[model samples]
Target: MTQIPDVAVHHETVVPQAQQDITDGGPDMVQFVDGEGTRLERTPANTPYADIVEALTPEDGRSMYRDLVLVRRLDAEGHALQRQGELGLWPSLLGQEAAQVGAGRAMRSQDFAFPGYREHGVAWCRGIEPEQLLALFRGVDNGGWSPSELNYHLYTIVIGNQMLHATGYAMGMQRDGVVGTGDEERDAAVMAFTGDGGTAQGDFNESLVFAGVANAPLVIFVQNNQWAISEPNYKQFRVPPYQRAQGFGFPGIRVDGNDVLAVYAVTKAALDNARSGQGPTLIEAFTYRLGAHTTSDDPTKYRSAAEVDIWREKDPIKRMRGFLSQKGYADDAFYASVDREADELAVRVRTACQNMPEPSQERMFDEIYVDPHPVVEREKAQFLEYQAGFETEGAR
Candidate 1:
């Protein structure tokens, strides 16, 4: 055996850039709409995406708004179920509705998506039932829906791991000659979703390196919702995720996560570029997590109330509703109908969550492997024997 050399490690204090403030995306951030619902005047930065936004019809606007509302409702219901002790835990997508909805709407059916656990809104866009998601939280199933059926992968709980999975899948698509085929129906791209914290993971960095080298048709969507649980963006890195993408040899864009139009246009453009053999793109969705990281967390402990208040002003649902009203794309009745639908969805979600059947204790051993192993069989027997001891004790 060869002797391993011992290397001393040095630690340095992280000094984030003062100029590159994570709080605001600044002028470079692509936004088509303002917080007040006004369509912004086209600037040079937004010029490329202007046509994409302009081509949207009133019906499309209504449909996007509908998705935003319904997804929000689904999220609200999930949060409530957790509060009511119906779920093991719930990750709320309270404020990032537009970021997810916009990206979800931008994808072609052939395109595949790998999402972080919090992407309930994206699941909505992918035709995943709210009950299916609830099943995961309620611990009824490993994954309630089929990834192949929806072209959406199962929710990846391990931080940043999905980036590798998505990159490998994109490279596979490249090998299969499904990318840059000139056929709209044939060309497909893979999208990997993660939070700002994910950028710090080695898997994310490795995936970017591989994607850049292979020119994989991949889009790494970083929903920079300000905080990585307790740690803020300032603690994550000196350069933001988009700017960091340049080091990996791909173009990256930061978009207003609250602006549905901007997110849709940017994501559509990025996906198009990937499909056309332009390689990977990193999208930093500048948004905020208006709620706790998960049901088990308390945002009030680590975050300030004032910060939450400020983000509430940039609420994606409110912003979209404002734009729809301003464009005359939806009447009051239409808004009311959407609200009714959301309420009905909430009821359905609540009912489904409550009705989910609890799995038998033996169910845990059923799918540990494709083929049964002696060790697993022994463990199952031990577990059953241990469980029977309680019954024997009760009889005594």
Candidate 2:
């Protein structure tokens, strides 16, 4: 059997020169960790984010670290499954894990989440097991789990449908008389996840209109991973997505999406405000997608290798672990233990994926007028008869 290499060696822990003090993305972006693995001494003004990060008990910090590590492993395993033909397709959520987990963990249990197709990380945070995410791509079922059970709707394939679903849900939550209830436990908000490309969809704009008019308690979390499936963000929108919220009469904020700490802080605050009866907030998580749009995509066609390398140095898991190690929040032993857990997770996911039941040919003709269909029964019988007639596997 081939041996799996050490996770640490496989992942280069080097912090590049350009990444040092890397607020170079912009001074305006909210960031708690500078690229050099050092937590910034000061927090961004007007944001009580630092206090939140500071208040995290050591357990809270470690739990977030575990969330990032596990989800990244889940994503990597999905990509491998697709490449090996175990799955038909996969949308790699490599770099966006932090953005998803940070935002996901910040939500209250009562809050609802409407996620795009690529929200594996969010699904993890919402209490869905990692292996369940593969059922769709494995072709066993077009639709996987029941959304209502998890309060997380189905993975939406249509670009901007999630936004509309989220907005409509938020309005329903209001009509249900749950919003602004003095009891924090009863009051809840809706979180909608979308990509930069989805923002240009007509449904997205329409949803915004409805949300603005209804004053829905919704937080539109946009993970601006910089690529709308080979098309860069600049090609899709002229202005930063968050900035465009002003025209719709809602507040918008951009955060260092790659920095999980910033993402958690911003998302928590946004949800709190929304649940408090403040209108929707559009948060543009300025992050990058480290992998291709899907297993089949070749990002090299449009994006440059140098750009990928640059983002590599700012990897969400690496930086979070780096800062944690530097600040003594977690020791090397804890990180190693997490690495072992990640390796085990990857193996378990592979086994589960390999064992996923494939749909039978008969399943296609399954629901022909549920009451009863003589014609459907006749057709099924004919097909089976024809198959049984052939002795050779090729003929069958």
Candidate 3:
């Protein structure tokens, strides 16, 4: 039995047996950095992906750092907006910045991505404006952008449903002659984003069966943020996600989710493998969520403050910034510039969110039916009448 870490114990003795190398993501995990922002020496397990990281220029590293900063700022603004009652709810991607940005930046323009509701970082990397995402959370639109235009699907609220949609889309790509075309511009693949908790859902398992059997061009990226809402990884499954992929007849790899360089290298290789018709691959990003699951949640009820503090030491943005600084890829000026941009972005997002026009009251009824229906019309009339009662009483 794998011993679980007991938070009730002293901080020094709180390490889990399964997590002895947690700082470096274990032997089975691909990692590029130690938790303190220092890069790790290449090892046999990570040697396969070393070239991808090696080929990245200093400018590339700086760009990724910039992305990490901006995405985190966008998420912070969203959380603040929810607390101030500006939005109905908001899911903050507080500690998953590196995992999303690295994977997002690795994709080619021709590739498509299907994401869970918390993939704001991926949306940013896909050229999606923060305002568009804010619109959805503001309850102003189903989704503010066109999926076809951006190659990013609408956020899937039903847990693990997008995995099915992604697999079907990947299969469709296979039918369309886009996979293994031997043309960099022509070959395309699909990526599906979900969290560890989603692996328990039937849809997730079913999608894997189809993807593996058909050898579909799909990459299932699971961000194991230590908890699915309030449940920890141990409770979700006896086996980790990456290990389970082998049972489905494909390769699986675990990466240090907080290490952007490692995440980028592994994801790029996986995408390339899929595009080349090598079939599906599962990537488990081992990371932590340092915030509540959502604005409506209170994480302190289930987890310990000591646990949160431990993960805080592994902050993704800080790690990237440290790498850039040590390598002299980015100086003080560049860091300052990114910080200024993040602040400006936060202001812009806040203004746009507050200014979103309230959708027409009749829009609910209009959206429910494409043409016209007697039942919908009757309900709409009754709703409008009921709403007008306050106005009638105010007139007195």
Clashing pairs in 3: none
| Candidate that beats the other on TM-score, 2 or 3, i.e. the better one | 3
Give the lDDT of residue 383 in candidate 2. Answer: 86
Please list the residue runs of candidate 3 whose C-alpha ends up more than 4 Å from where it truly belongs after superposition: 1-24, 367-396
lDDT tens readout by residue for model 2, 42-92: 744314566677766767778888999999889888888888989889998
Looking at model 1, report the run of 10 residues with the lowest lDDT sum: 1-10
Ten residues in sequence with the least summed lDDT for candidate 2: 1-10
Off by over 4 Å in 1: 1-23
TM-score of 2: 0.87
Model 3 global lDDT (CA atoms, 0 to 1): 0.88
- The local distance difference test score of model 2 is 0.82
Preferred candidate (TM-score higher): 1 or 3: 1
Expressed as tens digits, the lDDT of each residue in 1-396 for candidate 1 is 111111122233455534443357766788999888999999866877888999999999999999999998888888888898999899999999999999999999999999999999889999998899999989999687999999999999999999999999999999999999889999999999999999999999999999999999998999999899999877887677887887888887889999999999999989998998888889889999999999999999987787788789998888888998998888999999999999999888898889888898877887778898999999999999999999999999
Our model 1 lands, by Cα RMSD against the true structure, at 7.0
Candidate 3 lDDT tens digits, 1-396: 111111111113344535654334556788887777787898866778888989999999999999999999999999999999998899989999999999999899999999999999999999999999988988888677989999999999999999999999999999999999899999999999999999999999999999999999999999999889998776777777888887888888889999999999989998998998988889999998889999999999988887788889999998998888888788999999999999999999999999989998777777565688999999999999999998999999
